[model samples]
Target: MKYRFPEGFWWGSASSAAQSEGAAQQGGKAKTIWDHWFEIEPNRFHNQIGPAQTSTFYENYRQDIQLMKNIGHNSFRTSISWARLMPDGINVNQEAVTFYNNVIDALIENGITPFIGLFHFDMPLYWQQKGGWESRETVEAYAKYAEICFNLFGDRVACWMTFNEPVVVVEGGYLYDFHYPNKFGFRMAAQVAFHMMLAHSLAVRCYRSLKLPGRIGIVLNLTPSYPRSQHPADLKASFIADLFFNRAFLDPAVKGAYPAELVSLLKEHDQLPVYQAEDLALIADGKVDLLGINYYQPRRVKARMTAISPDAPFMPDWFFENYEMPGRKMNPYRGWEIYEKGIYDILINLRDHYGNIDCYISENGMGVENEERFIADDGQVKDDYRIDFIREHLKWMHKAIQEGAHCRGYHLWTFIDNWSWMNAYNNRYGFISLDLETQVRTVKKSGEWFAEVSRNNGF
Candidate 1:
């Protein structure tokens, strides 16, 4: 069987500034939360590696963009570092502006459309000192920063994402201790999540008011929640999980409002965030023009087997437990289950229930550790697993498109093997592998397969 993508389907991958762009302290870039966190607690990162140790995209973007073209990319997604652009999150840095302008223009010159994201978990440390997203003052400052980005690069960049996976910031920073500002408070997490949505809305409002030629949107890492069985309790658990993890951002961004059930649930738990009278109207006005979905894995949950103590602090997991299905295929390198059909399920849900907005698979790929073991005699990584992973997902994506989902394209998790967050460079998820020591870029077997897919518009 042959599968073909629609005409002009975008082909490329996604990356972030904090993860890939080294020169953390130089180039007039102020310290981000990641930078400050690493400085204070270096051991929190994998192998003691920090944000400063990245792919050096600041100095190597020209060559990197060429590598993108070599992989047959028609579009590429990378974020502008907020702290880099504005050293203090309020003042503009001209040197950073020049560097970004050059990168954007270079991508255009190489026939790759640039998709610029405003925030990718790199909050300026100064903002953290001021309560970060919890402070209404910080939210206003973020809106200003978004406005600055539009005034600076909106003319050249056609796709603008307000934030990439805002939920991760809330979950990692507040609920879990994985990210900076590590704390465990449901009240704080709810407040931060609300503020992030407000900030996103405010940025969208700013973009619309400027009448920018480009489209503005947000990227969400959507993990579909499935129940272990058809029991009523399991079904309820899945519904609640989806409400908190997926629709919390999806409904607001696409439908221009938060889910009513979510609001009632939060209120019942006394976890509602403070908001001004005009916040809802602002959110309603800031609906996205596009959506970027990052699907890595699905969440299989079952009803909680035990009751939570009344004295326990509130958490989303109180209502459910993770259900590991028997004989489920797994990505041994990454420990995530391989569920390709989840992509089609997400797309079909969007089409039937969420207005079928324009969207793309912004980040999807397999991450492997110690990839040197797979290097062939020709010095190329024979990443046949990644190729298979992508092809399986694409099959579902193609089925979704044929069934009337408004999906536009499929981009892998990343273009090059760059630094990850807390995991650092442990898991490499890229078509083009990066030799961290020599900074050498090599096209893997998956890259060759991707080139053919791009050239044929499918596989």
Candidate 2:
């Protein structure tokens, strides 16, 4: 069966500031959590490679934008580093303004629509010292930072993303040891999650107040969760998991309110975040004009066989145990299991529960280990596996569109090989491979295939 994407469907790739733009200390950029973490504990990063020398997008954006044009990108996504622009999240930096202006102009000159994201897992160290997302002061500082960007670049950028994969901020930084701050306390994690949502909502309000000619949205990494069995307990566990992982942000961003059940559950356990009535009002009034869903995998969950202790410390995993279903498709490179159907489930949920708000697959790609193994003699990678990975997911995405879901586009995780947090340059997800040793870019075989898809809208 031949399926074609809708006319004017967006085609492009996504990238973050910290992962792509090196020169962390240059361009009047202040220290971020990543920079401070590396300074304190250099061994935390993969191969001891810090965030100082990334793909160097800050210096090579002119040429890199051309490469994006060559790869058939119509709309490319990149984040404006808060620390780079504001240095302290309170004072605006002029050089950073000129730098981003050049970037936006370059992308526009090449006929690529610029999608700007405000925050992407990197927190300014000054704000982190002020209690990071756990303090109301940081939330207000973020709103000011958002206002700065909207005032500066809102005219050229038509799509503004408030935050990217916020759960990762909470999960990786507060609840786990993967990211900076590396605190394993559940109370701090809950507080961070609450304030992050508030910050997003506040930013949405700020953008709306400006009446910018663009769309404001949040980029969420959505994983359609599955219960391991037909039992009622298992089903409840899955629902609770969804409430925490997906609904936490989706409810406020799309539906304009927090999930009542979620709040009730947290309150019952005395884990409810402290909030003022004005904060609730802000969230209720703040709504997204669009939604960016990043789907890479699904979550299979089962109910815990043992009864929960009312006195136990709070955590999202308190209700369910993660079930790794046997014989699942796995990304051997990144150790993440892949499930194509997760995309369809995510779209359908948005349609039914979230008022079917305008949405798109914001980040989906395959990460490969030692991708050079497929490098051909003619200077291209025979990355057939990546092509297959993307094709399967796109098939499901196309099916979702036909079934009346409002998905508008599909953008891969990255345009070129770049660094990932903690893992540094371990897993490559780029359509175009980058040589870290020399910073040269080579279009992989998958890039050629994707270019055809972009040209034809589908194959």
- The lDDT for every candidate, in the order shown, is 0.93, 0.90
lDDT of 2 by residue, 1-459 (tens): 887998889899999999999989999999999999999998888898989978999999999999889888999999999999999666789999999999999999999999899999989998999889989999999988899899999999989999999999988998767888888777678789889989998999898889889999999999888999999999999999999899988898888888999989988878877788788888876789989999888989999877768886678888999999999989988888989988999998888888889998899998888888888889898989999999999999999999999898999988999988888888899988999888988888888899899998998
Q: Report the poorest 10 consecutive residues by lDDT, candidate 2.
A: 305-314
**Using alpha carbons, what is the TM-score of model 1?**
0.99
Q: How accurate is candidate 1 locally (lDDT)?
A: 0.93
Q: What is the lDDT of residue 454 in candidate 2?
A: 94
TM-score of each: 0.99, 0.98
lDDT of model number 2: 0.90
Among the numbered candidates, top TM-score falls to: 1
Query: In model 2, what lDDT does residue 17 have?
Result: 95
